[model samples]
Target: MEDRRRLLKALAACAMPGVAGTALATPASAQPWPVKPIRMVVPFPAGSSPDLIARLLTEKLAAALGQAVVVENRPGAGGNIGTGMVARAAPDGYTLLLTINGPLVTAPTLSRHLGYDPVRQLAPVSLVATSPNVLVVDARLPVHDVREFVALARSRPGVLNYGSVGNGSAAHLAMEQLKAAAGIDLQHIPYPGFAQITTAMVGGQVQAGFMVPVIAMPLVTAGKLRIIAVTTSGRTSLLPAVPTVAESGYPGFEAISWQAVLAPAGTPAPVIDRLYRELVAIIGSEDVRAKMRAQYFVPAGTAPQSLRQTMASEKVRWDKVIRAAGVQPE
Candidate 1:
């Protein structure tokens, strides 16, 4: 019993005011945060939008944090592998998750057997950006507008198909949400990645698809695909001519994939606050804004509490859509 008491005293001493204060203050002047390179785990393969953003953010964060911020891709099982890894990783503010909507919100509701609970295992630090999906159809499609497309899909039922980046992906869920709201019956086709979605979409294999504007915009400009509407709350400045789906008659319709930084749950509040402060500084820079604009994402550096609220609201929203669509884990 005496030995146990001594051990407890030793642990308390380590966290005491003077000792804890010194250790925490060591990373200031003549010192650097993350004396070693930090790793940003991306749950998708390279070249994908999320992966590209992760790399961009890593470069910027590395510069801002005065350490190399490396990105590691562990793509598999619809992003479950990498996401689970970060969820169980050390909460020392060194390892972080740079990802989009799936692993954060959709995966938990869809994959009932997933190893980690997103809400319980991770905490949001900062929101990087928000990107809306663009609704585009092959040039050969008869439909010309959102209304016409809805009519055609309703008439054809399962004949006309829409492609998404992958099953349970943000694109898929967006389309599912659209279908429910419009009461249309279009067939859903899943692709392995955006590359396949592009190929199939341009070749007329899939009549329509939901893809990021940056990617589909080039095809639309090339006359390979015709963009019908922007699936966001307001018209995108990039495509000023395209009307938003909400304006097209679907009230309260909005689907956006937000990228953000997150640390594992149980990370000390001070650590989270410090990281958030640094990230906000970096994200607010004009250089980072330029990078985000180049990638077709709107810069949105929200507070930690605001990001948490957004996540909770998003979970509630997607949970309804997933359940209504009868989507289940594979």
Candidate 2:
């Protein structure tokens, strides 16, 4: 009986460890993930489109997560500086990136020495929004529609010049795609930003180029510029009368600027899942939708996998466009 009692005591001690091990493996939800403030890095200037969207969404995300979500603008090197910062950040879900396709897709192909590989370094959380680019010409130009503009460009060849934010920018790529499809020769005049591009276009320094509706519509309405076509699959709500590039002639011409959220690679799956759910809810809310529409943006709260696929596909598409456009990085 003494020996049997000794064996029972040993078995009980072993069983206690198993029970403790199970407790230690408790689900991640029970753990306080974001016990403190979270930082959302926007790889653009403070008042830029990406920054504005980040500020809008962070307010709602903070409320949902019960923590402060701060927007830090670390703009430089065409958004690479902020992007690389997030890519190298700890994968504890404390730091997030709210960026556009430029850094993730085009810049990689344009720049030979980009510090971070977006697909390899960042885990996609969600696609926040997408906005179409409008092909607007100077009011003084004689073109009334896309066909007319193409004809005029063909007739003038390299004499007509178009402006873009810079080489390999979305505007630049869109125009390049257009040039390839329409088989016209137009000189590309790269500027520092959209403001400069718009200024040049309005001043008749350049003939035409692609621009977002928010910037181009005001000028178009003011009789400074004329939108020949929109570069999306469908017409934008902001300009219902404007035909899409596809509708104008080309079949598969779709160029759009998009914004998405991402976390450092190896971020805990539970945290990423939680963030995605909150982001989807926030994006679907009426207030967010209204605000997005007001800014001429189409709100798109897509799955993480969707964003990954989009990044992959865009990288391939832009590679071809950039090569065709003959845009070399500085």
Candidate 3:
């Protein structure tokens, strides 16, 4: 109360003609929100899919907000490191998070030591984009499709290894679910990020894994990697030629990966609302949608309530997958 009175007095004194230049500088509390550059934290390594998308989106967001929006990579712990950072950040709108499903929905069930509860600490803004993970193998593996790969894995058991960013990542859960469905066994290799996974696959450190289309397609095109099936129930336009795992042999199989914007829980409703509105507009724009689609992403400008529901449903879906794969919480 006293601070408020001081601010009013100072502001009023500034209005006086002769005192305008002499009055104390406006207090930070009196300044409008976004008075400075806003930091959009991406909890993944640079050049990762989320980083690519964040770079694309923050450019427009900065212009829209009339403030610079800088994307900072806080990669590690399958996105938990950066996610926990944002979860613990001050709820002042200056710090924001753009992340994927790992730290949001799956980690609670997959990781024994996950340090943050996304449900309790983060406020959903909107789901930014959605994409299916593509099942890809090193070109040397010689498996043509999901059936061939599963057969090989079933025969080889734990001999075949796959890589993912970390536990609770889309690749991790997707492969585990596929393994359980196919009754095959493959060893899991966790890397720090997809870039490392891609490198490892190219180097033949691992045999097969799931990847975003944007990252998998280039190598697939170059003959370094062979993409067989997508994790979606149906094929995506980015890889329309690629059949889905469900279409191959397994039924009712899906593992869709997505990105969403969020603020720390207890952030002002106005800030969340404004961010949501701006994100929806930017994502819904034809040009932005075109770019996202070209990159194999489908823009999902859902309402905050809708995103919350997505998180809830995904949590239920992955929980069962985790347990079925015998992934005990650490």
Candidate 4:
């Protein structure tokens, strides 16, 4: 018995170094988080605003993190498909979603059966950028400003039609908000995407619509479209001469589109912190700011908590607008 006890004690003592070595080395080995390439899912088509922003940041992020950041376009179902992909992705910081306000804030209220809950399944990393929508009309239209447009609409109710990217899109909601505030009747024409909406507007299929500054400015400059008013409370630098919808007649009319970065829920806090820091740095940098400004996107790198608050507040805000607009889920 004595010999057996001594032998057992000796074996136990011999195993201590190996056990301790593993316990100490495990965390060290895991310290470098991005051991592999990271995939950023842009829940919009390539060349879309959100995708452009993602591609803009990919190289910087890759350089900073020492890993290849791949931007994948997965556009479908008003951005729900790609968003759901990221929501269901593993919470290891390997996958992320860079999207606009439509999917994160408005879609839940618009769709009855979303596969993933953004608030519950995704973690906010940063609010990347924001840009106001420009209300533009076909150059052939007689109206030149918001009031003129309203007058024309009132005179020819339902005769003047507006096109939007989709039913629940920001463009659609902005028009609905305008209709409610201005008490004008205009027909709503829903298109599959922005390209189609631009085509319809140019072809005179629709006389007017709200569009992003990047798309509207070129058309306006080319005499294909005319900018009547911007959606934000203040005029954009891109269209400094154009008045705002609020200034045109309505006082509190403001509908700004924004983009943000998010990860699957349960992502490590440290990883989230690192990403937030890097993103804020990148967004706030002069070069990135210049690029964003060239695209008419206002650089905004809000903290995660602020973004969360914005999400909650926007939900309440859009809910009222959508309900007031009488937009029902499809």
lDDT values for all models:
0.82, 0.87, 0.91, 0.88
* Number of the predicted model whose lDDT against the real structure is largest: 3
Cα RMSDs, all models: 5.9, 4.3, 5.2, 2.8
**Can you tell me which runs of candidate 3 are displaced by over 4 Å?**
1-29
TM-score of each: 0.84, 0.82, 0.91, 0.91
- Deviation of model 4 at 294, angstroms: 1.2
Q: Which stretches in model 2 have alpha-carbon errors above 4 Å?
A: 1-31, 151-161, 203-206, 324-330
Summarize candidate 4's per-residue lDDT along 218-300 as a digit string, tens digits: 77889999999998888777679889999999999989889999999999999999999999999989999999999899999
lDDT tens digits, residue span 1-330, model 3: 999999998777776755463444445326777889999999999989999899989999999999999999999989999999999999999999999998999888867778889999999999999999999999998689998998899889889889998888999999999988899989999998888998998888998999899888889889999999998887777778889999999999999999999999999998999999999999999999999999899888988889999999999988889988887665
Task: Score candidate 2 by TM-score against the native.
Answer: 0.82
Give the residue spans of candidate 1 off by over 4 A. 1-33, 268-270, 328-330
Root mean square deviation (Cα) for candidate 1: 5.9
What does the lDDT come to for candidate 1? 0.82
lDDT of 2 at 239: 70
The best-first sequence of candidates by lDDT reads: 3, 4, 2, 1
Worst ten in a row by lDDT for model 1: 24-33
Better of 2 and 4 by TM-score: 4
Residue pairs whose backbone atoms clash in candidate 4: none
Clashing residue pairs found in predicted model 1: none
Q: After superposition, how far is residue 149 of candidate 4 from its true place, in Å?
A: 1.0
